[model samples]
Target: MIESCSGIYRIKNLSDNKFYIGSAKNLKLRWFDHRKLLRKNAHFNFHLQRAWNLHGESSFEFECIEFCEFEKLIEREQNYLDKYYHLNVLYNLNPTACSQAGMLHNQDTKLKISTALKGRVVTDEHRLALSISWHKSDKCKKQNEEARKKASLSKLGKKESIETRVKKSIAHTGKKQKPHTEETKRKISETKRNKKNVNLIKGDIYAEPS
Candidate 1:
């Protein structure tokens, strides 16, 4: 598979119990093109598209994938899929195999330019003239830099609110979530009651001695 934006995909055949599993970096573009080819009744048709039409989308699934660096992932996955699914078959021309097998056949014919067209070569004088015309204008540059600095300062000045801080803490705290136990609930209620009592006592103590 072309190591696109790093995604795993599979196309299954409902008619036969066969399946093809592969990965790509750009799953949407790659799959969309595959679907289009199937619509046009193209020869390099994928069985997964057939299964989607025949059995529905629920039939085909790509399982157990983690996004990672492309160079490491594609080679590792290509080998893994080959072993797990026996998908490295040369004769098979489904989506997984067709790209590999038909690559030789799809070689683009190289275009050659016979001769260069004779033209006036720009000298250092011409270069200076163009640079002076465009690069000397400092108004647009200053305006652009000022705008960029204003945006940067605006973003930097945004303080995290209490709600945002709590959310961020919850996300980054490596605590596994669990349902609250009876003991934990009791402790929480006690804490709330203590705080309420403290507030009440403070008001009474601070009141005028009448």
Candidate 2:
């Protein structure tokens, strides 16, 4: 039932009887998330979205196959996928029967994703929201030295596009910046000396030169 929902859920297409299985920490929240996406015709899974648009929301059903603790959710979900694994015409878009928790995509998978996402357009409003959320996110607010180092390394050798630069400049047009204190400047200088891969632009004290 909805009151005590958790663990695995199945979204069944009543029209064809095909379905997809998934796990969540809170079943109620996950159901609403899927419903919102399907209603907006913006689900990440093209197969499911196409079905929803064709059959409409009334032709679908949300069923809780079972409930389990949060930690057991992935294992249980994997079991479900194995039970319903198909060779062809499967409803699931996920390539694996395993959970995605703490998973780092392999280079091949990353390249495939990058290729698949080529020419995808993000709306300006969505881009602005993402920038604001990333800056204000508490998840990275207390990053330790290791986390900070890893973050910096991941962004190494990346270059911003001219359009991105223009957008950033326009966004910062009226913003006032405070000068770095002497101690901050020393740390900056020390970091520059320690890292040979960094590029520094002439006038910018924050980022390396372009």
Candidate 3:
């Protein structure tokens, strides 16, 4: 016997000839939530919910309890729906959105993984090659070291948060920010570029001496 909360449910809306696939850690609660949404007529608020309510007929049917990890279960359910029912052809990102993430480290994690592996999987030969390559390549070694340092620092100190950064960026541009000017660009470029060299260069570098 399988518990309702431990697996996925595939629901069919008979009136519209469309299907909905989803996995819930607590399947009973999820279904109950859906029923509540329908009862309250909150359908038009979201895409799938809207479809399920407006086009759906009375007496929906569901198949219960396929066992797999949450991500794999959602994927399997979606595959079944797509192959047989052919409902959600566009923007079906249910499984993709289920991935675990440390928001602060998501980009860094992806970059580190891609930079380190570049589509190569680990095998005995690959491991040996990697051992050899790690010693041979300064760039790889540096990247590995930097990644490790960043990870360690993240553990030790309070990392700058993605949410905070987004809020700060929005605040900086709030309703009345001025556009960039040529003088502003020149000042910025001068500040970032070689100040000593620019100061030491011949008189009035911006002008061509006649």
Candidate 4:
């Protein structure tokens, strides 16, 4: 029976000596996740993904290099990375063995990614999933609120250039606006009633201080 373990691991391409080094809390599960993403061509490490695509799965091997405690995982992984990185055989994009919190893509990589996604259309399901994921994360919510506040502050007293206004007008010209559903209208009405500031006269909706 296979046992769960935490350690530094290596994904080696037999065709070439190039390999990716990583550390995981559960090596087996981490390797499984890597294979799944590589097979789907959606691996976060594009360098490794490209290598896997070129070399084929049969030519690669996943092996544990050192078994270490979870606390020392990053340190151990960093040592291995430092050793192999000097030889230029690593598939890792970043030389630092760390999480992707502050990783910035180079201009070339950013351009390549932008070009690749330029014509891609997000499906409604994918859009909904992204929205749900964003909403579910408190960190994301806080970041979004901060960003919005910063944007509002930055835009305060800013006037649009005539050229910019013209471009926006052209962009919106002939665009059909979707009407809100009855449910949405009902929710709006309920919110207005709760606020006690909204007034309805004839067919116009207005807000007045209560």
Candidate 5:
């Protein structure tokens, strides 16, 4: 039986001495929630969840580090976080206490996520759903367009590596590209002409004494 109290808590992994620190109004309820989510592998903290999965429940110990008033819960938790901020043993995904927003994952966590997603497969239904969701949002479409433009600008005058060129060649080997429509051709020609005019104005392209 756990005591119900407002306090700062630590969930420590006995195996590695790594731990996650948090505070709650009711320590007992919070501990219960953590265990429930961890058992189901659905904890909001992915770092803690992964560690719990790697090292069984028996390897973890939960304890109330300090009993504080409800108002001071966050402050107390932040103190513990600051104390261990530089250490690599903390399993906390967020550097700050009280809120999990705006926290960037460490490189180790990023590599772990990359490795976990490396061979994951997305179903056609899932892919279609994602496409539909993106298409449904005007903001997403605008942002995507902006990203494409930025990427196009960044790639200008850049040479691809030999390996990249070979991979692209292989990928497009059997693909047939559709011919541009007359309207598209006209637009392309106009764009090129405008670029040439700009370059001539800037003295980038030499005009032959005309």
Candidate 6:
């Protein structure tokens, strides 16, 4: 009969006797959230998620550590965190016990968030925050295959300039190369001759290669 009350709570994994300390405005509601997330294998905290997966629901015990005013909740959570900071013993996931209640977003809201940040200039502090967020994200580890293919296709059929061609020729000047086959030579000559004939028929032939 845990009631909706502001307090510090601890989730004890009975399997390994590890503890995770947190505080919430409503003990009952927050406990329900933790149970739901763990059951779904979708908890935001990796350490807590792993524990839940390793040990099933029956192995967890939710206990009210102490009741506190809503304003002093985070402070009380931090005090509990400090007590368990030594020896890496506690399974507490937060580096600091400064957690806000989580929120859920649908796909449309996620898209809106992405659109809003489209052309914003990122400051160093923002970059650091992004680094922290992306440190454990799978998206940062690999490029999407479809995105890579789209990028490749975007550059397709782009013509190189004469300067670029000359620079490339200069770079490969001393490399060994294959001589053109007779068929290739004939095609090249025929192409040039057709261009010359076309220019001549127009009565302005000399400016082109003949």
Q: Which residue pairs show collisions in model 5?
A: none
lDDT of 2 by residue, 1-210 (tens): 563455888899999988878887778888887887668655656677778889989999998988898777766886777677664445775534444456465676566557756787766644554554444445557555568899899989999899999999999999999999999999999988866444543335576657
lDDT of each: 0.52, 0.73, 0.56, 0.77, 0.79, 0.77
Residue-level lDDT tens digits of model 5 in 83-141: 99688879875566652323465666566557756766765544554465456557788
Positional deviation of residue 6's Cα in model 1 after best superposition, in angstroms: 1.1
Give residue 113's error in model 1 in angstroms: 32
Cα lDDT over the full model 4? 0.77
**Weakest lDDT window of 10 consecutive positions for candidate 5:** 96-105
List TM-scores for all candidates, in order: 0.31, 0.48, 0.35, 0.48, 0.48, 0.48
How well does candidate 3 match the true structure, expressed as C-alpha RMSD? 19.7
Q: Which candidate is the best by lDDT?
A: 5
> Model 3 over residues 62-87: C-alpha lDDT tens digits?
55647666546545554554565434
Query: After superposing candidate 4, which stretches have Cα over 4 Å from the reference?
Result: 1-3, 100-210
lDDT of 2 at 209: 58
lDDT of 3: 0.56
Counted clashes in each candidate structure: 4, 6, 0, 0, 0, 0
User: Per-residue CA lDDT of candidate 1, range 22-126, in tens?
Assistant: 555566566665555444433133334344566655554433344555444444445545565444432223212223312232222111111111343555544
Q: Check candidate 6 and list the clashing pairs.
A: none
TM-score of 3: 0.35
